[model samples]
Target: MEPFALTVALPIFGLIALFCLPSRIANRRAKLVRNLVTTVVGVECLFALSLTVGLAVKGVPSQSIKLIEVWRDLGLNLDVFVDGAASLMLMLVSFVGFVVSRFSIRFLDGERLQGRYFRWLGFTIGAVSLMVVAGNLLLFFLAWVATSFGLHQLLLHYRHRAAAHRAAWTKFAISRFGDALLIGALALTYYAFGTFELTELFSRARDLATSASQVTASHVAIGWLLVLGAVTKSAQFPFHTWLPDTMETPTPVSALMHAGIVNAGGYLIIRMSPLVALAPTAMISLAVIGAFTACFAGVVMMTQTSVKRSLAYSTIAQMGFMMLQCGCGAFSAAMLHILAHSLYKAHAFLGSGSVVSQALATTGAKSPQPSPHLSLAYLLGAAAISAFAYAAVSSAFDVNVVTKPGGVILALVVCLALTTWGWRLLSVGEITTMLLGMTGISGLCLAYTASYLAVSHWLQATTPLFAIPPTPRFVLLAIALAFCALFWLHFVVIRRVRPNWLNSLRVHAANGFYIDTVYRRLLTPLARS
Candidate 1:
């Protein structure tokens, strides 16, 4: 088998091996099960690393291999495809799997269902790995559903806890709804293109793009269906009630769900960017919805008192931002976001307990309150410095921030983030601190620009270069203004200004605007039946 083929096959086989472990061995030899699962995951990680290195050296654009012919007539075949996006996702999932498995061994020690936990964990990881590398829509759909089911089991590890059961059931319901949407999208895709194979579909889509052929209603439907599916899976607003409520699950399960599973929605959009971009309406919808979710979740995250709940909302906000990047046709940035967010969320989830303990141990200090004049000056200075730094780094890297898709807005977003950091640092009122903070911000800007350039290069072959949307300048200006307002509001809240309306808003934000309550009320009758 080719190296790429072997890498894809390993996960499926590992999943089988895990399920085939005897009940007696699993129940009695927990340590052995732990070692076996860890070793398998570790080896998978190594394979992913080697695959990435190999691809880099050879510069192979993309490769598709049929692993099994389940039913040719029905377009149901097991296939594996590798490209920049797949390779990146594979490496991320494998590394996170290995780490989480190792962590679980210690965390779940002496638990009665330790062996069962390892089995499901391995299955979930394998399923996700396979999903990322799937070559055909059918294979991808199967793996997607399999991952959900496997995770469902893992979420129910504490079967006796009613809250765990409720969360799991809620997730299951949402996932099934997503599955339906995906199925509709896949069917429409086959109807329009007459192929489930990704390579052929992409080729045909590109042909449509290059030709004067108008997009049909089926194409538009496929795009809408896909966006709906992705939003549900990624816990976008109105369907995100399950995530924060899932704190009853084991920590490892939470880690995997946030770090790996939640990213599936963004991955789907990136993988199918060629087709999805055909519908401007869909793309615009994604941007609007994603922007709303991010803003909504960001505010809610700030008001969360529980550490885990806070992280849960943070994941929602990050996923929303990622989706927004995709909707803006910034596929490369979206992919980069996935990779960075995955690593950060994994660590955040795994170390959440330690984080809470440390927070309690440390005494909180009031932030220094500089005079209003000095504060305004510092803010303005930070904004200027951030913009200059970003522009310089982008120019150094030979990147045209203005011409790229969603370039201007994303660049400004980065600048805004840096400005916030700088402003906070400057407020510290120490020369040494200001110098160090500026240095750190400079390094971060350089690193971010470099990473974005590299990701764009890697995805050049696989992803389509989307044309800038209509009224790009207008869109950029509007978004920039909105972000500035948000930043101002953040400071106002922090300083406890306008306690009357602000307190009311905080209550609404903390309750997620009662969206989840409405969902539960609507579903109560059906759930009872």
Candidate 2:
């Protein structure tokens, strides 16, 4: 079998088999079910790994293989496009699917919906896998719809739960809106370029961008439509409330959704980088909305009492950050962020049960505050260390990817990381332990930066570096500074009791700034009346 067909078809066949098995058979043969899922997903992961490794060794091959042809005159075909970004996403989906499937073997043991759960789980994985590899817009849309339908089933697994049903419906509503935008985008692409193939569209897009005067209304409309779809898919701003409510779903489903499905927006933006680079208006909109959502969700995350809810908000903020990277024309950084966030969020969701115990352990523990002079020293130390580390890593890796918004935003994140470590060390009473912790944190940060840069370098083909516009540059910097300030404030609010004014803000934050209330109020009356 061809590599693409093998990778895409295996999971699909697995899904079919899972669906065919009767619930009683799956329940009675639980071990067999576990083995089947593990083997199928594990093989998919291996196939993805092989493809990725081949890319590294072969130096970014332009490999496209058609799986099937759906139309002749329209030029629509089910083709697989294998690039660094696609490879990374495939590996991520497969590995996460395998891990979540294995985990669910025990996590959801004896649940009545075990067979049904596996069926949807398998279907979602297969659908997502196909979506990432799609070479034609038609196939991409089909896979996209499949994932949405499968996810809705998974979200409403507990059919009797009102909250779950409500959350599912909200998600479904948002998804349809996004789908409409995507369909419009596809239609525009076909109208403009006369083909649904990515390679053809990208070639024409390059020509259009080069002849800046040739760019037209359709180009701008298509770009905005794609971004709008991505914004809804990633759950930014107004669409974000549904994500937090989705905690009513199963843990594995939450992991898959947050870790894999939610990253679809970033993936879409990156995959269409050629076209996105041409639309300054769309990019600016992405930056503005993404920045606000990141800050908003970050603040709200701090006030969330429930661990799962906090994680949900955290995903929103991370997705916003990813979108911000895209807006900055930091597609490579966005890809890295997607990969890192997926792994981190998956682990966080799967192990969320231990959060209560961890919280209990830290309940009465007092953190030591440094004197003014000492605090100043720590802050200076953190800034110096972070700057030095960033410079060294960038220089060593030859990552001259220091473009406007992405570079500054990345620096802010580094500053936050080092400063948080500095605070932690200040609370440590032992000098030796503090020094050791500082050294360890610095080293880990260096390693992470280097690895990210290396991956960014490899994925450069899929995401060509682009520069942000002048006005958006200033706006992005402001957003970056706001996030840094918000980060510091979050640290403060979490460690101390809030005052009266701050308590009001906390209530607002806890209620997600009343956005959901407004949504319900506006929609509910229309439904009833």
Candidate 3:
């Protein structure tokens, strides 16, 4: 067996082995179970890391290894695909599993269900690891469903809590809907291409792109189905209610779901970029939905009083942004976003207790607010500095901010964010502070451009870089203007510029525009049944 293949297979065999331990015995010897879990996860993490490092050094192209042939006629087989994306995801999931396992050991020290928790946790991790390396749509779909089942068990660990049950059921329902969409996509893929293997499917897609063959209706249907499936799993718009309500689960579970499982949606789109990019209408729909979800959740995140709930909304917003990146054909940026957001959210959730304590410690104190009286000239200057910094860094990395798909819009967002930060410092009215802020902004832009380029290079072999359907100039302008308006609102809110309309808007935003309430009402009859 190839080293990469062995590394990918180890976690699936080792972690799933935990399920073989008798429940009665496991509960009796909880400490032993914990030790076993830690050791297995730690070793798996090391192996995954080495595989990724080796891939990076050798710059291996994507390859698929067949492990078993279940049914040749149906194109059903067990296979593992090795590529930069899979290697990176394997390392990420394994490392996160190991950390969470260690954290759970002390966190659930006296819990009655500690052994069961570890068992399900390992199962969930194994399922995710398998999904990451699955070479065919059939195997990927199986692993996807398995992951949800494992997570369902983990969520119900606190069976005594009514809220926990409600959240878990809601999630199960949504996941099933996503599963249906994926099933539709799978059928359409087979109908259109006559193959379940990813490598062959991608090859066909590339051929169609380069040839004069017109994309058929099945291709469009598959694209839309995939978009629907991804949105549901990632908790976009109305489907995101369950995530924030899931605080009843343990912190480790929450961390795993937010940091790892939630990322599956983005990964799906990135993995199938060649196919998804074929249907411009589907891509447009994805971009619109993603942008709306990001803006909506970002507003709601500010009104949340609970730290965990805040983080949950933050995850939704981040996921939305990542989806937007995918819809824009920036698969590498989306991949980078997943990696960064996962690490950050995991740290945020695991350290939430300390965060709450620190917040309470400084409850009575108020931090300095940006001055509302700053001149418009100063704001313009800040924007100029931000744009200049981004352009300079992007040029150094040989990135075309104008012609690249969604490049201009993404650059605009980055500039807006940096401008806001610089504007705040400028409002402080300190020359030294303004200079330091500009320097920090430049450094951040440099790092952001460099990281994006590196990820793009790494994933170049796996992801397709076809010409994206051109977004209309008017549409791009509208998006830019909307972001600008949002920036102005954020500025006003932070400056304490309270008005009756602003207050009214805040109330609505705080309740997430009551979207979740409507969903609950609709689902109430079914739940009662």
Candidate 4:
């Protein structure tokens, strides 16, 4: 009856029904069951959408309802918590589920094990919804682990492939390690503070901030430990190998991870961002790793022949951007990127598949699942970047080595990726049309990246980041003027020049320099080894 019940209960019930359905759909009865199951999922998605609309109109804090209370002696009560944050995440999950569902209508038109797929789909959306709305650490952690295991199951839904099974095992194995770390972190918090309550922890944090004691600094070690748990789960560097490998699953599931599940990392980073700030070093570690992942992954994106692998790297890059923001002490900036990127990335990946599918038609062969590029050096590069991201994203106490983080500097990293990509595409893509499409997309990315500065500006005006104000307006103004220079050249000089100088400059900016070669060189030895 409660919102949380509808949010949590209905999906769990659907999962039970789905799990009960036979694996092989041979009979009329089985087909009927599968259809009914899909219909139910559809209903759940619609309900979530309606809830989102209401939230937009009235905007209630993320709303959650707890169903049961066990272990009352231990101060453990199962509860749901919702606010703007949870609502946003739930709404994103719901919509992504529905889109994937719509896609499955055509994507899995006559597929076997339809029931298994649909059921897990419902369960995933539900678990994520529960995750967003969970009230306390116990509830959130339960949902977190459930979703993690559920993803493992979903990854292996197709029964035959050794690779699929292996990917599933990898997810499960990594998630279990992450689970242990998460539980350990929670245990420390509980032992130190005396409760497993989220609100209580926040209050405790505020009190500690006001206190003057070495013990308070010790509190930060626990916070970083918790951050480690979140990073591993979210596929931040060092642990990111599993993500692109996850492509062994169906396309829709791939979409779910990129557009929805993988986003859980961003959600956790934001949800606990306040705590992360307590250890600024850890927060910057997040940013450094994030920025490098973006830059590194983007370069790797160039090498991949398969569209899917390229897109996977793009997702990695997006995750990196979110981490960079976290590192830079731009919480809302990161949050906004997460939301915008999810929707657009979903559409882009879907569109990319369609384009690739057309290429498959030319061969008249059973369309190969796009090749998964497992580059050795890239993995190690990612590992190094992960180390940097870790330091960059940390909640820093002092500025020293923490400032350097890893991979490379953010400005250099991005300049390199964009420059390399733009130039390569310009050289390869033959027509004016292709260049336009390419530049438009690149510009959109640049806009997103630059917009952060503006938001960072406003955020600084309103709140203090490490007791320092935002960058001076003169810098931002200069950045803006630089862009204006290009705009001016585009309209005035370019037409007269006859060569479209603006287009050429766009080509130049896109090259991101010859940075890709350097990355390749850095990675070659690792790749071979």
Top model number, lDDT: 3
Q: Between 2 and 4, whose TM-score is larger?
A: 2
Number of the candidate with higher TM-score, 3 or 4: 3
**Pick by lDDT: 3 or 4, better one:** 3
By TM-score, is 1 or 2 better? 1
Please state the error at residue 508 of candidate 3 in Å: 1.6
Model 2 agreement with the true structure over 1-529: per-residue lDDT tens digits: 2554456665655664565677677667766666777778888888888888877777764456777788889998878888788888999999999999999888888887787778778878888888898888778888888889989989988888777877888788889999999999999988888998987877788778767799888888888988999999999998987899887799999999999999888888998888777788898889788888998999999888898999999999999989988887777778888988999999999999998898798888566766657765766676676667666666776655354446767667766767677666654557886677567666866777777777777786676433435435578668878877886676666447467888888888889988987666554443233
Give a tens-digit lDDT track for model 3, residues 1-529: 2666866687687777776777677778888888888888888888888888788777777888888899988988888888889888888898898899999999999988898888888888988989898999989999899999989988988988877777888888899999999999999999999999999988888777765357888988998999999999999987999899889999999999999999999999988888887777898778777877887787888778889999999999889888878877778889999999999999999999899688788787454664444456668889999999998888888899787878888898889889989887777678898899999999999989889888888898778756777766776676677777777888677777789998899898888789878767766555444
The CA lDDT of each predicted structure is 0.85, 0.80, 0.85, 0.59
Per-prediction TM-score, please?
A: 0.95, 0.92, 0.95, 0.68
Q: Candidate 1 overall Cα lDDT vs. reference?
A: 0.85
Model 2 misplaced regions, further than 4 Å: 1-8, 13-34, 359-367, 371-373, 400-405, 465-471, 494-497, 522-529
Error of 3 at 293 (Å): 0.5
Candidates 1 and 2 compared: the better one by lDDT is 1
Worst 10-residue lDDT window for candidate 2 reads: 464-473
Clashes of each: 0, 0, 0, 44
Q: Local error of candidate 4 at 488, Å?
A: 23
Clashes of 1: 0
Candidate 1 at 250: error in angstroms?
0.9
**Residue-level error in angstroms, candidate 3, position 21:** 4.5
TM-score of 1: 0.95
Q: Ranking under lDDT, best-scoring first?
A: 3, 1, 2, 4
lDDT of 1 at 263: 94
Superposed by TM-score, candidate 4 places the C-alpha of residue 168 at a distance from the truth, in angstroms, of: 2.0
